[model samples]
Target: MSTSLSSDAAVTGTRVSPPSESRLRSNLVLVTLLTCQLMIVLDITVMNVALPRIQADLHFSATGLSWVMNAYTLVFGGLLLLGGRAGDLFGRRTLFIAGATLFTLASLAGGLAPSAAWLLAARVVQGIGGAMAGPSTLALLTTIFREPKARIRVLALFSGMSSAGFAIGLIVGGLLTEWLSWRSVLFINVPFGLLVVVLALRYLPRAERQSAHLDLPGAITATSGVAALVYGFISAASHGWGNATTDISLAAGAALILAFLAIESRSAQPLLPLHLFRDRNRATAYASMFLAPMAGMSMFFFLTQFLQDVLGLSALATGFAFLPTALLMFTMIRTIPRLLPRFGPKPLTMTGTASMVAGLILLTQLTDRSGYFPLLFIAMILMGFGIGLAVSPLNVIIMSNVEPHEAGAAGGALQTLQQTGASLGLAILVTIFGTTSRGAGGSVQHALVSGMTAAFAAAAGIAALTFVVAFIYRNPRPAN
Candidate 1:
């Protein structure tokens, strides 16, 4: 749900011998890719638990602390489209390695940062690296596994890593901050990144570059447009929607996006293919992906606050609390490929959506008196498994039947909407919490719970919309 990877068995006209050695080699390659994905996803929130510590050690102003996260989100979301197309044209493997390398070096620089400016600059580099590598991570996975079923299994794992990574990031951040220091959160990525780089060098094949115009105009508009939109959402979350900065950023973002879409419609070599949305199933899948995160991200943000502000849980305990969700989610995701042949994407998506909705409904029952009890634990489990169920099929549907060259762009758009949803969800939910808490006539704890429950209900509504989208899926069998 935190938002959003594949295989290759050769399908000859005649049955070919299954290459055991080839499968093993592909598995090794998958390890490299998943580790890279885990690193990227983990970094997204790995610093979250350590933010207070970061503010203290770095003497960050209360207002400035939010930038630590926003700087990464803005750049990362903005350049995703350009990065996707660049990978498609320039060679996915090349771009992946370059991006991963830059991210690793930036992590090192960030870990050693003596000032807030230095850290923020490093975070920007990390975002750039993430955008360049993120789309290719999925694109390359599909390239390696040509067989449809194998690709689905790999995608399941790739997606499982993403959903799990967000929760895992919280845990890792807490442990690092508690046992070591806030610096450890940034330092941790260096080793992971280096390992991914080394393994990729050993295992990944160099892609043949496509011959095409670089689409500089598309790149410019897509980058600036998405960046502006992300900034707008960030500003909204921080300063409310009425702020001039938020209004300007949001309006500029809308204008730029419209311009970008117009360009894509006419351009022969568009960054995002307009035709991808022609398939009702694929379009619905993308919509579900966008909505899924609106629920999931808000849950994470509000629940974290509830754990701390209401229940008075320590950072370490709060981090560990999410373990049930992550574990259940990972378990369910691994089994999704098996279910796909029986129930298909539509059923799995609907079921997952229902489970998530139920989970959010349970969360709405939280009160100032509530503790980490059966209800909270059950809700976490449901939320985790629901997301695992819903996300993989959507990815399979999007990547399925996609032309090999277009995989990067598809991955980019999928993730771009996803990140956009995450930012916007947080903004909207935070606003809801503020309004409800202010209006509630109760003690501070009651007010906090009131606001949280309101947000939870809204999150449930968003999650239910995912079911509506999933219900639109008419395909009985998987594509490709």
Candidate 2:
């Protein structure tokens, strides 16, 4: 279970590198990490396609069905920091295995659920499991691959998988929903999870545990703050921002966050180090990660609704509609490692954010009469390429300043921000879309189109802000 990689010349210095299993072992490591990541990422969207079937089977109210997705995201996003910190304090490999096992079991429970409550309970557990395992995937990768050249390549692939997995999930969900039962979407995780667990057990190197204590107060306040904040935003879509519950939740969330910050500053071992944000590059990277996913995830949410409701596309077709974006993202990610040395993070991220803005702006022009061929297709491609180029490099820069020991915490923080941003962004955009569509009082298609355009415009504005952040980001080499 524990392997010392100090003997490998490829992994040297303060970091432990694996033995020269060379290409094969390297490939195995990548596969193990990527598979685990894919399982976690794909689950976010896989259930989306099956929502109608789930609602029908469980006799869920329209509003209640949304919880099927929200339950997972809320819990997952809220607990990521704790999970990441745990990986650092405990062992990454140990948590990774534990997470994978829990996820697999939760997926099984979800698939076999006899009622709405059962499935929702299962999803909550799935979120917990995902939070536990998700951060460690990247942390372990950073630990295993220390050589810059090899690391970039692996990072590129990891980035591609992360971006592509969501799109891929839509496709898988559509296929399973149409061909098998909706339950199959949940069932699909069993094999993938088991594979990750097995491979991780066999190939993943274990790190020594730290003697550091968990910041229990920081964890409690941070998790509660984030969870409450996310809940408020998501609820704002259903209950207007003026609603008492939404207002109270938002107020409490803000208070708790301030408390978490205060606790973190004083804690001997903070759940999230306040010092990590002191680095300009890491800070910029974190901000960009939040904004990029915010826009990107919102696109998925509304685009699915637009394609299904306005264009009259089937769930299966809607999934394929995102294919161009996914394909281009994968293609761009492979090219990023080569591009990084030439341009560095600034130009790449600036260009990427600019592309996303352009794509989103174009999407804002969408009308009910708009065709998929040149308009939506091109936009998706641009967005995907933008996400690939921007996110992967941002990840590199984020980790660039971090010491090896801080990798897990940094990785966890990065993912937590991304997820929280996704949830927050989608909720805000959904509220805007709903308000616009309702105010229009036109044909459903026209109203929906109008709402989508408004959401896209807002997303573009967010992306523009990210571009500004990327432009000003400067990474001065730390004095040796």
Candidate 3:
């Protein structure tokens, strides 16, 4: 069979023919899509190593520094469903290219930001670009790879790359911040984003838009609700959880979310189709996706501070400390496709979540005199391997049975949960850290250590929920 996709509808108002039969072109399409996914996921943690520098230079307060990440995730998580629906109603390739362009521009603006507010604004725009492109990346994958085995292999690679990108961002961000400046992290995305656009325009096949309308009201409620929720939690870090503003924001967020669910249920064309929730495997995957990342993202946030503040590690050292986890994740994910067919997602997800919980529990035991190899190293390796086993398989489970028409929305929903999990998880964890730290003696090191330990304990509890969720799939469903 010919590997090229459908012929272009038009370019420069001139119709173009499909490329001749070539497996290489098909492979290139997968690579390009994977690269875009990597870039988007990478941004989530790339600036982490540079947070202290960004805070000092941009005059961000300690509590406010978390916003550097929350800002991007809030909008990315909120609008992702709308972005995916737009891709379905418009064209995936068109949105992919446009999103890449906007992301590249936003990265440039962020790199040059002169103040905290300026940088935050750029981050918001960057998140919008991410929301637009992230889901389409997977939707395109489903479109191009029709065969089951080939799709599984490529999706495994996609999942591995996404996981690795977070770790790679840490190391790269560390090196750039230490050797050059913190701005290098944002600037690094420019060339990669442009390359993705150019290749997508050249090789990616275009899909005709489905006859669906974008859910504007659904988008607004979801986006606003998630943002408000994150803000409320982060506010708790500063003003205490009992503050009036925090209570109001939390209440408003809950009401808005309920409103969103009501709207989604009644809309003739729901932003998130209700039927997708009916599938036990997919629902399990989505639930785990939300909970797993809460622990995973907290590792990045708290560990960075622990290594730097407690262990007296530099930014570069802190970044490199995460390398073991990245390496393990990359190595482990490649094995999931082979293992998944035999054991089913249930065993894999259960074992993965179990490992993650173990890692988080170990992290909670850290002390001022703890050695890296005995305490932190073992925990990182376990978390890395566990996440590897969990994440890729979960992706396959979620996307496997989705219809081509619903692929974008399915992908959007998966990613929305992932990003929201990261944002809110970090916020809640940060609040825990803050609350605990304040009660410690005058020693900053003791305070920070206490906070991180408390956060890790809480993260372990969140991660444990995944094991219960994984057990919900009493019998294994075929990957399809």
Pairing residues by index, what is the TM-score of model 1? Answer: 0.95
Candidate 3 C-alpha RMSD relative to the actual structure: 3.0
Give one digit per residue, the lDDT tens place, for model 1 in 1-480: 111112213332355426664555577678888988888888888888889899998999999999999899899899888999899999999999999999999999999999999999999999999999999999998777767778888888888888888889888887888899999899998988998999888667666788998878888888999999889989888788999999999999999999999999999999999898998888988898889988988767788888888888878888899999889878977788788867778999999999999999999999999989888989999999898888867788888778999999999999999899888898888888888999999899999999999999999999998888887887777776
Determine which window of 10 residues in candidate 2 has minimal summed lDDT: 1-10
Question: lDDT at 315 for candidate 2?
Answer: 81
What TM-score does each of the candidates earn?
A: 0.95, 0.94, 0.93
Descending-lDDT candidate ranking = 1, 2, 3
Ranking of all predicted structures according to TM-score, beginning with the best and ending with the worst? 1, 2, 3
Candidate number achieving the greatest TM-score relative to the actual structure: 1
State, as a TM-score between 0 and 1, how close model 3 is to the true structure. 0.93
**CA deviation > 4 Å runs, candidate 1:** 1-21
The global Cα lDDT (0 to 1) of model 3 is: 0.83
Clash total of candidate 1: 5
**lDDT, model 1, position 19:** 67
Off by over 4 Å in 2: 1-22, 475-480
- State how far residue 396 of model 1 sits from its true place (Å): 0.8
lDDT of 1: 0.86
Better of 2 and 3 by lDDT: 2
